[model samples]
Target: MKARSKSKSKSSILFILCVIAIFSLAFTGFKGFKIAGWEIKSIGEAITKGLDLQGGVSVLMEIQEDDVPSDVRQRTKQLLELRVNKIGVSETVVTEEGEKRIRVDIPGAYNSSEIVDGLSKTGNLEFKDSEGNIVLTGKDVKEATAVLDSTSSPVVSLELNEEGQTKFAEATANNIGKTISISMDDEVVSQPVVQNAITDGKAVINGMSSMEEATKLSGIISSGALPVTVKAVSVKNVGAQLGAEALPNAVKAGVIGISLVFIFMILYYRLPGLFASIALTLYITLVLIVFVEMKAALTLPGIAAFLLTIGMAVDANVLIFERIREELSIGIPIKSAIKKGFENAMSSIVDSNSTTFIAALILYFMGSGAVKGFAVTLMIGIILSLFTALIVTKILINLAVDMGLLKSLGQFRVKRGAENA
Candidate 1:
């Protein structure tokens, strides 16, 4: 029965070993593969890279008029961030530069004109009566589409929401046979006479000179408008060559750093150290998978946070191992020592990592751009570190002890006096 128990333990350990090997290769190995007609991309290729890592477009914009209110500027910044992100550029950084300037960095985007057009145009669609009083704004529009009229001419059709429908019904009813001006950013695009109240919440602007004009108007109307007028002051295209060089260097440094940690763990704690290293490997794989699946943008600061967390992870394991050593010194049996070690270390690990987790949350919420990137990575690392130390390392160490692979306290480098105890 004892032999059978040892055999079972050994098989479990072997299974763990296979998991480590397979996960390492599958996630960090060469590119990725296809399964059931779906291509699974490697973490390197699949993860979203930030502007500093992938390089793209940077545009500096400023309010066209002086003395813009803070709330207006803030609303403009928020709107720009949403607008660019909607265009499918992930991890775009839109930050306030100075009192008057705003900087936007979009990774993997190259079209300067499109970027400028999407951002600089206030797109504030307004309707006014012949006397020039504002009647409706872009906020009233539910949908905008570029379509052809019965005459087969390009036009923009607008659909108003419920509130807009009632408002428009009143406006048209009062202004029959009077011209209503449709303007974008105070530039009049069309003036159509309202012949009747005929408001089914739908209206069309007829004066689009071309299909492109109609399409552009429709898109801007649907995307919402900037609260303030802004113009691009400077536009620069970022090249990926620096990012191309930087990524490999960062990866190499991480590899070297982690490799050194593995060596130290193995040399110091012996069997437990070996098991800790495996747990560390699993920690990294799981973290990267989280990042990829979350579509989190990884930047230079994020990578630094990642490396910092690795040290934290090792620190956790070290604490647990020392506790185990202390337990063994008191003459506890191997399995009981391993279990007590973790139980004793649990409070310290949680206490230490929990503070860091709170700090990460604060930074993530209050900070922006790269600061946010760092906070996100740090937060992920702290959670994973705790998990690996409390659960993964404990399981592996207990398994080794049960399999009789760890036979003496000396394997954990406990003092020679305890080796015989």
Candidate 2:
């Protein structure tokens, strides 16, 4: 028994030390390691921040009429979001603010006026015949790009899908020797005369005076149109100062809260508490790694969800630890008690976490903007917490028992008088 215990102790210690070292390096980063696909940095630096944290432009747009339908409002918000994304920004928030107003928040944006002007346009790209008949719409265009024509003039190029190709061919064939006007929002931007059939599924708008105009027009064309005309009511630039101050304060609070939990667990559960703390650390490290890999934006609400997950992780540990103590009080062997404790607690852990997971899914699908951000982080946390509590904590505890580190009942927070049955 002594020889077996010694061997188990060596192996368990080696495994535990390996886990600690690897996670520590991942959390803080190492000189040679580049797991985050770039320069090695702390976990905090790897995550992308939202507009509230990084600062950018915020625009509020209101529809011209008072009684806009809900579907129109949603479509407008979605189109604005697409336009923002087309300009190369990520994690932009576009949501309906009221019955007639929509709000847009673009992170890392510097040109407020440019964004507001570009995003508020009623895209409505239309191809019209010489007789003013509609030939094609923006929906039929597959791609749009800005390029210089052979004459050294900037123009917007359009690649038509099968449907657009057919319609455009018919329109050009019929309008030969006549001008077909290309218009956006009822304003004609190009009126090129048709010289040939031009049935190759491609067309060009050549009225742009500069490359910038061509690019902007192409981007707007690529990102579809809004159903209704909206006007920007407010546009402002936000600074990073608010998030800079709040981030540190939030981190400090999380540290204090986790530290208190650590102290309480160590005092109440003795040996088991120390193992739980280590598992908790691993849980946090894994969560951060996942966020980095996903390139997820970390907002203030996301940070709050992260902290809440720590408590949920610790709660699972508390449940399993209590179960083990109960089994120990009945004079069960340490290894058997650990096994039974995990088995008994599995159902409850799955039930609770699964319910919360469902709720998070609902919030993710039905919610918008900041609410979606909160739901995403909460879902991630619950998953990682479940993994640490059920798998990592169990392995650590079984290792301790195998290494004879739990020979005394007091190690499990049970009374010493509970005689071995």
| Model 2, position 35: C-alpha lDDT score | 52
Candidate 2 per-residue lDDT, tens place, 60-162, comes to 8889977888888888878888887776667777777658888888888468887888887889999999888999999989999999999999999999999
CA RMSD per model (angstroms) = 5.1, 5.0
All candidates' TM-scores?
Answer: 0.74, 0.74
Residue 146 lDDT in candidate 2: 90
Segments of candidate 2 deviating more than 4 angstroms: 2-14, 17-25, 28-32, 35-42, 57-81, 93-105, 110-113, 127-142, 148-155, 158-181, 190-213, 225-237, 326-332, 343-367, 413-415, 418-421
What are the per-residue Cα lDDT tens digits for candidate 1 across 87-149? Answer: 556677788865678888888846878778878778888999989998899999999888999
lDDT of 1 at 11: 62
Error of 2 at 344 (Å): 5.0
Cα displacement (Å) at residue 126, model 1: 3.8
